[model samples]
Target: MDAWLYNGKDADDVFGILGIRAEGSRSMNSRKLVVLDEYINLFNARYPSAATDSFIVLRDGFGGEADFARVLSMAKLRPESERMIANTSKYQGELFSKWMVEDMLEPKGVLSTVLEGGSYGTARSEDKLVVNHYNVFYKRRTREQ
Candidate 1:
């Protein structure tokens, strides 16, 4: 199972930009530990197969780092579990600006390339363009062979 978790304010905007709808809610503001526990429980329940994979996408500047830290702590508690954080930034603007070579623009080309292509693409586009302009973090628990 896969889930996209965004801050309440940006949820709708993100959905619109991605041309997809997501369940908008403000749930991560609760205790971080509680959220982590709930995530682990839900993951275990939803993906019972050892070979199945699950992921979560979180927006930066909205307690994303804190939530990722909690996931790391969860990994420590269960050595069999693994978690990783992939952070990125982007400068969104008109389509032409994204492909321009000019040094200065409304969304500076060089800045966009460095932040979006260099960091965001390198991290998230390893497989495919799953989500844009969002930091992706994932946890995996595998059964011992």
Candidate 2:
């Protein structure tokens, strides 16, 4: 497990000390989190046809990223899709400039993900599980199986 995680990433061999009794220190790095609220605005600007939708619905009842991305994948999307993709890529590049690549790059590209843990399904102690580690596993080699 340890080797799988640290194999190509831990260039300093930092993770190599995991099981050994070792000490470390830390400090706070100040960073300004830029919250992007331009989605609705940009959507409206780029897709004026969507303006008929209620603002309340747009604000409080935004659809899932999967739904958005799925629609975005359709072939005929025009000004809106182009603008959205361009702006999202811009935001990602901006974030990476201010932070570590590890902090900015995400599996879903434009969406943040939550971590999941615990045994997969109904696994016994000896059973090898093939859990979907989601973002992390997808970013690297398939952790499942």
Candidate 3:
């Protein structure tokens, strides 16, 4: 994770350049995740010390379920990053989307979540999302915005 964050060679390395900082904590199963402005990052670890990092870029999910489904479909197009997003860490296969919305309501995590039961329009896409288990304020690309 640090490698890509500092190297800037990998596709997700932009996080480092953007001055984004990642804060991580281990789940009961010892898994990790990193979410921030426009991104939902999930970490898969095989050993206690080693982990493979991947992320999903949040798109327009303001339309609720329809937008979530669309964002997920587009996420699948990313053969490399989609691997983690498709893997469910929670019951609804939401990848902690519920918590993301909560984070914003409290700790200012993501402005809103994009899953089936997520909140909408609490924030603008331009707002920076918080990092850790955590967080999307994706730009509005719709005609409505």
Candidate 2, residue 112: how far the Cα is off, in Å: 12
Could you tell me the TM-score of candidate 1? 0.19
List per-prediction Cα lDDT, in the order shown: 0.28, 0.28, 0.30
Task: Please report how far candidate 3 places residue 1 from its true position, in Å.
Answer: 19
lDDT of 2 by residue, 1-145 (tens): 2343334322112222231112111000101001112333344455476442222221122233222222222211232344445543343233333222454434443232311223333433211111121233344433433
Question: Residue 29 in candidate 3 has what lDDT?
Answer: 16
lDDT digits (tens) for residues 15-95 of candidate 1:
243421121112222233234445445554654552111123332322333333233333223333122111111111112
User: Which one wins on lDDT?
Assistant: 3
Candidate 3 minimal-lDDT segment of 10 residues: 21-30
lDDT per residue (tens digit) for residues 17-97 in model 3? 433222111111112323332222322222324333332322121233334333333333332443334332221134334
**TM-score computed on alpha carbons, candidate 3:** 0.21
* TM-score list, all predictions: 0.19, 0.19, 0.21
Clashing pairs in 2: none
**Better-scoring candidate (lDDT), 2 or 3:** 3
Candidate 1 weakest ten by summed lDDT: 84-93
